[model samples]
Target: MMRVLAIGDIHGGLKALVQLLNKLEIKDGDTLIFMGDYVDGWSESAQVIQFLIELSEKINCIFIKGNHDVWCEEWLRDGSVDMTWYIHGGKETMESYSGFSKEDKQKHLAFFENLKMYHLDNKNRLFLHAGFTSMHGVEKEVFQTTLYFDRTLWEMALTMDKSIERDSELFPKRLTHYHEIYIGHTPTTNFGVEKPMNATNVWNVDTGAAFKGKLTAMDVETKSFWQSDNLPCLYPNEKGRNKD
Candidate 1:
């Protein structure tokens, strides 16, 4: 009965993201679940983060760390590592907060570090930044790295034996254990290529907001989806290489 509005990768598309949220007109009892990658790619990383932080005060918001977030964390921790992050739109994120005080930087870092890996809703739904892997014991032994980088589980999910009870009381697969699993990362194209079985237990919302795709969001209870057309990249992909 919890109406959760789950948004996919924002990739710093602040305008598009804002429009999408405005369209939703979030109300009380509705939760906003961000699947991470809040910074990088687009031109308004800092603004987007600031907006989401403020929005969190009004609504029930849960943030899950994505790969880009991990990189941002590292960049903030070490000022000298800017080059390593700039390539993947990190420069824009830094530029967004170029005039911020040292205190501001510390606050942002704390927010990033505090992101949760996953959220479970009364055993009916699961929200995670990335898919899980068997090596990590599905829902039992979750690691920070696995939550952000585990693609192997996505591959295995495709081959899940249909004969087994999807929601079996015993061997509970992550997806099967919950009524539905919401995830971001492993682009839809990758999911199509890796999972040809048409697995329906999991839902992938990451529409490649940073690439030549769209920014997407899904209404958990309604199962309705919304998207915004791809935005122009601030820097050419080639020129922004993180060679540091």
Candidate 2:
């Protein structure tokens, strides 16, 4: 059977991503869905994109755009820079592209330009970089930013009393419609886990790779997973963003 994997934010952690991919044992027939935020954070943004491009030639891959990725894409496409992104992880992402030729840079930009905001898999699962405001179809076109920044959904899930049957008055219909929703903007490390964190029907795969945690990947069919060593350890001498 073909494996389906969902990966979380890479945050330019090339070494960490390389190690995790090795552990994932990816095959040509497998389908991979990346949760995005591929650039900004660590110092290897260019290298990370290089790896993704190579990986695509061998396997089917879905790339979702995260807020950080949008900022980086803007910089690459028009020399536009956002100070907020720079203050967080954009500076490193820009620096990583300093040595690349224009052609190489354009190739990576094309990859960014083509990213999806969300992906619905064959198994009735929704894959995205962040939470969403509603399951209503039009929300994606109206409040697209919510798709990459909302957190109320996670908060609602966390507070639900699972022991009680879901009350439509209480439990959101949008969340229950999907068999599963996989997201990555909020790192599981914030919930104190170094692996994927499950809350209700949503799985937060981001293990804070942009910070001090690992880059994570999981097999949807088997519920099996792989992770890299603490990202800070992977780049010992480099201080990623505000890691002080």
lDDT of 1 by residue, 62-105 (tens): 99989889888887777655665677787777887887778877
Residue-level lDDT of model 2, residues 84-177, one tens digit each, is 9988998889889878999999999999999999998778888988887765532443688888888877787777777755555666776766
**lDDT (C-alpha) at residue 189 in model 1:** 44
Best by lDDT: 2
Alpha-carbon TM-score of each model against the true structure: 0.82, 0.95
Candidate 2: global Cα-lDDT?
0.86
The parts of candidate 1 lying over 4 Å away from their true place are 80-84, 135-139, 159-174, 189-198, 233-244
TM-score for model 1?
Answer: 0.82
Q: Give the alpha-carbon lDDT of every model.
A: 0.72, 0.86
